[model samples]
Target: MTQEYVYDYEPDYDQLMADIETLIQEGNLEGVRNLYETVHSVDIDEVLEDLDDSSLRYFLFMLEFEDISDLLENAEEDLQIRMMELYSTKELIEIFTFMANADVADLLGLLSTRRRKELLNYMKKSDSNILKMILSFDEESAGGVMTTEFISLKQSLSVREALLKIKDIAPETEIIESIFITDRQHRLQGIVDLREILVAPGYTPLSDLIEDMPFFIYAEDDQEEAANIIFKYDLKYLPVVNQKMAILGVITSDDIIEVMEQEHSEDILAMSGVSKDEEYDSTFASSVRSRLPWLLVNLVTAFMASAVVSLFEGTISQVVALAAAMPIVTGMGGNAGNQALSIVLTSIARGDMDLEDDWKLIVKEIVLGLFNGAVVGLFAGIILYMKYGNIILGLIIFASMIINMIIAGIVGFLLPLLFDHIDVDPAISSPIFLTTTTDIFGFFVFLGLASIVLPYLV
Candidate 1:
């Protein structure tokens, strides 16, 4: 018996790669399998990078189809595309057989229309139809991310009967946690925890075990909406339904997690004045096309900020310190506004902030802005006083900082609300507008105060 190499989180990738290569060279394929038997699939994914095209293809055949399905799921998009190119349709179909419906849809989505159609043609009509239906949904909808395979028990079934049914179908099911209960019409009634079924007597009726599940969503609902549903109700999984209330599929925790991450990424991109398309499009033309519009918008706002500065040129000429100090006010204001914007945007996205209660949130943010400004402005003012040896200048800095912070807060809070009301995404348009507001006001207030106190400073 050969001793197995056991690794936990971090595996020695170089050794694994070398050992596998050396075994393959020595014609000990069985030894290669045994050597990697205890190795993690993720570690295998890393070692795969060292292999050339031919070797990589050969190495894939050594792994089980189930493992390949997982690898395909974990692999980067480019590599996944390459893997698709490397495999014949038959081989891909075999791998797809082991993959979840959602995973198959995702992979199929990456393929060209003609190529995807070709693969679909080879699938069983049942599987092909299911895949087509899932693919037909917008990539950001609940149906797009949901796995079509799930266990649905008849509400009238006994515990023993349900257990027998699950046993027969569990292998084909995505996961078993909260099993959905449905009527004879296939309309979902409720969901019962698997634990409840296990604890109940074998003869106990499923209807007695079922609990109310008023949290189901239409298949056409946004994936983010589905995610919100999960968060709002603390659900493990949400059932997707048709207008008839018949179950179409299930959105599991994994799907919710993906939706959240993608949404956050999209929001971050939008806030940063970047498009979501730019994230995946690395080509120079694609980069320019996706990013140029926002860059131009920012440039325009930047000039507006500069124009505000030009109005204070006389004060700036008299005291050069004003030139250096003015930016600190505007920069700090920009930072403050961004902070408020992030909170408001997240609240709006999650539907946590009620329309009726908007005033409470607005007042809270404004107060927070004033409190932060007073404390932070004091520190900034002290620093200015020490640097320039002028009390009036320090006081001006202090006052201006407070004023700009307040303005930043108001703009940040209202900008998103205004844009959302007007049917524009606050995430995409708010940042640019906030930059202009803070810059113009920040310069005006700071410079206006400096002009008034110019005689004392001189």
Candidate 2:
């Protein structure tokens, strides 16, 4: 019988961090290195992010070039800059060789142009040229996120020859799961999986192994488009081509995964009225700077809602009950409007909602609002009637609730579409605008109705 060793897959993160900190403080380099080797690079990056600046620098110094490169590739932009600053030009050059070209380009894009040029001077001419080419493309394009290190073979090459070529360059290539088969002019012909080549006859031409009508994206296309394609097709690797269909580079699934995560984070932050660049651990001044503008906008909208309330001060004074019930109307309406806004914004982000069918979505939301409002308002009306013994007051509250909810639905559904049409991000601005609309209208309608029924209540 063979003895087996089982590892604790769910090791306590806090305990591991404590151990790492002790090792760092004691200057136990070998122990730290051994401990780090047991954890994944992503976990190491997370732990490094939490470490104090001095400890982080010391730990980074102990990492080999390959380990440092992996950390830099996985770390956030600010951390990447900090690590780069700690490294000398020669060290940076050595680390860059181990990093993927796409990662190198992204890291360089964050540096000052002068600094980028200086760093480039230390890299090989070929590597520097690839980074420069990637930098030439917009940061949000397929070309920008793609790695130039991919295996490509002429369609006419036999399977054995292609395998030999792949074997020669596999060590340098970032993606070997799928090989691009191109024409003599380097035009993308199709894609063939490495598994297919392994199983095919040695004499079979590479073209025979090509999948029919393989999916690819243009290098200049939006990075989101590439991400969407990868998601839709469940792809392992996607080829990037130019207008002439010439293969420029390849975007592995890992690149698209990163893009998706970034996009989701940005959308979530924008929806909360925070700047996408604002991090929780950012400097206090930066946090204030990032948030103050949105707060100011909300303040203005709050005053507008107050202005509507001021118009009905007399009604509230005469019937104190109106003031008691006022918040329910506006609160429910605001909640309803936000529901619509959330759905529409998500649909827009996922490219699900058609612009031309805007009216249909609006109508659907309106109907939904009316149905929900009727159910909610009925209970509210019944409660008011039982509490105040006034049928007219109950009727007024019911009508106001329904009307405000309808307003909420309309405003919420249309604002995002309007913002998108004007080339603004709907997620960032929609909630602010929708809240303002619901508040102003919710107060106006509820108070205006209360005033009309003031004689009966008083």
Candidate 3:
């Protein structure tokens, strides 16, 4: 159990942190190291995060460089910077050398350009160039997330030769469940499973064992796009390529799982109108930073809805009853709009729907809205009729409900698609726009009807 057991076992983290602190005070650094040996990287960072600056700086060098890399990878921005600052440039270079290139690149990405240059300069040219190239890619992209450590081979190699090659380099490669076979130019030909390589005759050519790749992505493509392909094809590893079809790296299934979770989180935040960049938001400021801008944008939409109501002030004042029923109409529309928007965004993200399917998709949502509105409106209208004993008012409420619901369906179906057409993220702004739309148009329909029927009611 090499001390990497995590929090799932309900370990008392407070007691552990206390022990580590006690050991540090007594000058028993070895005891502190043994206590943390069983701790997970996340748990290690959590304990480190609580330590005062002086204690943190002292304890960093107590742990091995490998453990240091783990903490740096999972730690918060401030903690990562602080930890790096405690180490000299030479020490930082040694620490980074112990990390995977992908992890090193990720940490470098958090630093300022000048600091990044200093660290990269300290590393060997080959490693420095690879990390630099990775840093050049957007962290949200396939190239950026991919680890450069992978097994690559020439098709000309026999199975025996490939096996010897894997034995020599397997420790250095990140994963070797499969080996990539490429041409002399390093253009990918196909992938072969380790299982297949082991069972085949030693004399068998590597080309004979090649499995057809379902798909490959460009390095610059979004990580979520790569995730979708890997999910759809059930691939364990997906190849990333450059424009020339030279294989850059493999995006493993683990990476895809992380990407999928991040994409899901983004969608959830988008629907809630929050822009999320952090998960370990421990402070009031972080919570406010995530939500305040979206709330401000939504305030503008609320004002638009309020303005729509103000336009009908005369009509609403005349039929004071309309004020009582206005919420019923807009509330139904907002709910319906959210339902359709969720479906659209999910389908678009999964590549299940495209612009070509727009007409049919729109027709289906609208029909669903109409059916739902008819049933709901009928009940509400009957209730209003029984209460007010005014057929005109009942009929007016009924018509308003149906019109608003249909309007909800239209905006829900069209807004996301429209955003996507303009190359914008469809999910991010749809909810705010959808709610405002339903409110504005719903008010117009209800108030306009009230104005028309005023003479009869009076």
Quantify all predictions' global Cα lDDT against the true fold.
Answer: 0.86, 0.85, 0.84
lDDT of 2 at 86: 86
Q: Candidate 3: misplaced stretches above 4 Å?
A: 1-8, 278-296, 386-391, 456-458
Per-residue CA lDDT of model 3 for 325-394, tens digit only, reads 8889999999999888888888788777777677777777778878988888888889888887878888
lDDT string, candidate 1, 1-458, tens digits: 54455666677777788876776566565665665577766677777756778777777767677777877888767678877888888889999998888899999999999989999999999999999999988889998989888999999999999999999989888768779999999999998989999999999999999899888889898898899889888877889988899998999887799789899999998988777867563789888877888999999999998888898788899999998998889999999999988888998888776445686677776787788888888888899889989989989988888888988998898888888878798899999999999999999999999999899877
Top-scoring candidate (lDDT): 1
TM-score of each: 0.90, 0.90, 0.92
Which residue runs of candidate 1 sit more than 4 Å off their true CA positions?
1-8, 16-28, 156-163, 194-209, 277-285, 288-290, 354-356
User: For residues 372-458, could you state the per-residue lDDT of candidate 2 as single tens digits?
Assistant: 888888889999999989987788778878888988998888888889888799989999988888888888888888787678888
Best by TM-score: 3
Error of 2 at 449 (Å): 2.2
Steric clashes per prediction: 0, 0, 2
lDDT score for candidate 1 against the true structure: 0.86
What's the true lDDT of residue 162 in model 3?
A: 95
